[model samples]
Target: MRRVLALAACASATVYFEETFDSGIGERWQTSEWKDPMGAWVWTSGEWYTNEAKAKGMQASEDMRFHAISAKLDAPASTVDKELVVQFTVKHEKKDYAFCGGGYIKLLPGEVDPKAFGGDTPYAIMFGPDLCGYDISRIHVIFENKGENLLKSDEIKLDYSDKDEFTHLYTLHLKPDGSYEVFFDQKSKASGKLEDDWAFPSKEIKDPAISKPSDWVDTKRIPDPAAVKPEGYDDIPAEIPDPEAEQPEDWDAEEDGEWEPPMIDNPDYKGEWKAPMIDNPDYKGEWVHPMIPNADYAPDTYAKYPDLTTLGFELWTVNAGSIFDNILVTDDKAYADKMAADTWAIIKEGEKEAKDAWKKANKDDDDDDDADVDDDEEEEEEEELKDEL
Candidate 1:
């Protein structure tokens, strides 16, 4: 029993990686080889008023192009554990609104060349928030298994409220039991089994051998044999001359065409008959296809990447102004929660206060400009009056 207990202790979770960006990105993080002529990633002291607090962080160059950056692990970390968690904070501080960009990170295999990374590079896992025009605002959770990269089939909706501008934490938890959960600002926004959410072959498929018979009485209604059409039903004309219509008295029948009143719909006319439906006595309920084991389907152990070597942010943005910081990749959930509470919870309040203050100052500046414009218009009016005199 003591030997088993010792083995269980050895398998517990540990914090294998972290990056707070307090000190510079250092030599560990490397920029990708794929470069956009228009833009690049830069390290700065945050954006807006938040810059005053944070000494160093990474953000896009605010140009309309792509940006890719990566950081490799000292050694590959094994993902064969029961649970794996990744957490990071991102701030979309584009004052005029963000158009399109990806705030996600990718977990690449050990064999990848950090310098040659691009969008086409293969990754073991890809997860985070992605935004486009008004329609698309979602958290993407993609996993690679057996050479096929499968995106989560179900929609992962995100809160696109006013709070999006502030720095918010995004967390993804993957378990060996084939379950996953996504958290926003440390709150669970979405959770589901991996197999059910991903676009993989169904574990059970309809039995192809069985099918509905040709003579199956699926219809609920039949023509009534006792009921007969009314006596004058066929004789009744669809249209008749209007009773209130009158012919013109000046009509000349010899030279001009004959004058007639416009036809009106016959009130007695009835539409085509349809038999009234009753409960279907011979109905075999709705025909359901019997499910059979899918020959090609295999259960995912959720341990696809036993060795995770590199983590990177390889994405494209149209109007770039997003800051990414405090990335943590660990097998321990407790450690991740603690880090978020300590770092994110503390600084978020200050960031919000500063953002609000900046907005108020801009409003005041605009009001003053309007006053100046009004005064100039009044002076021009006085000059026009003098010229008229």
Candidate 2:
């Protein structure tokens, strides 16, 4: 043991371990205080410690005061099956059982708030000195969700000395192939493979396969390995037919196809709306019409029309069959009433007005003709006077 200690110390002296805090500002280490029948202690922040020379500087307070708690390192989340090394030292504060146990190291999910959280799915490695004769050590892990305790708290009796306040190391090893072994003082204490060597209590249990025994001991009862069914029973049924398969029997003919064009049932649609040839009932513009009937005559022939070259207005098929220049109106009341009375009446009225304007213009043209005739008559009179002279 002396040579072993020296070798361990030398190996540890070669390597260094350190703790890193990645939390942001105002969020450093936090501790929780709790008191129960087991006693009172504070839970601190998660830390990583390794057996190295640097750990000498990182040692817990050597002062004869409060006992420093040890972290679980990497314990099993399901069955304490993972390899883990728990390290802690005992102290003599008042010399009267100052430190109780080394406390416990729990494998927690990386930083989650408990109040906002619901389930307690953490795994742990726990060891507290027993008030009874021997010191107790346990790799406590849980596989079930929201459970309060480990699935198989198989308390393994650790072979250790009791009198002195010494530092002890417990290494729990779990192989990649699902085999587990526990080592105390650098020596293997237990060994067993997972599914084959040990069996679970039930095939459908949430607890892992670690809840089995390697071989039956004299005192303990090693029950028969849990039963496992054949491969296909694990999955859902694959042969069931779909209820929504496409079929004429399930189809509703009345609801199918293009909604029957809402036109057949609606009475408001009077087949065709013969556009009234009169001013629109909704028209609020000046009403104008052409003197000559031209199907191609545009309403804006008399007024300034929009620049069709710059505007994209060619999309419309002009219904240019109406006889009128565009009617301009400030109110729709007269136009709507007149249009409703007789579609052709509005155009007749505009035609009358155009004829009157034309008659007046022709009368002016006749007056102009007479003025030219008078000039010729005046010249003839001048010539007669000249001859008489």
Name the top TM-score candidate: 1
How big is the positional error of residue 356 in model 2, measured in Å on the Cα after superposition? 99
* Reference-based TM-score, model 1: 0.79
For 243-298, candidate 1 gives per-residue lDDT tens digits of 89987788788866887889999998776655555566676666667899988676
Candidate 1 segments exceeding 4 Å error? 1-13, 35-38, 50-55, 95-98, 208-217, 222-231, 242-263, 275-285, 359-389
TM-score of each: 0.79, 0.29
Cα lDDT tens digits, model 2, 1-389, are: 00111122223211111121112111222222211111112221112112212112112222222221222212112222222222222211111122232222333433433222212323322322222212333433222232334343355444333322222333344443455554433355566643322223222333332433434232332223443444444343433344444455545666774322221233222333233243333433432332333343322221111111100000010111101111111112222223222222222233334444444555666497786686578657545643553
**TM-score of predicted structure 2:** 0.29
Q: Which candidate is the best by lDDT?
A: 1
- Clash pairs, model 1 backbone: none
lDDT: worst 10-residue window of model 2: 308-317
Model 2's alpha-carbon lDDT is: 0.28
Global lDDT of each model?
0.72, 0.28
The superposed Cα distance between candidate 1 and the true structure at residue 115, in angstroms, equals: 1.3
Sliding window of 10 residues with minimal summed lDDT for model 1? 1-10
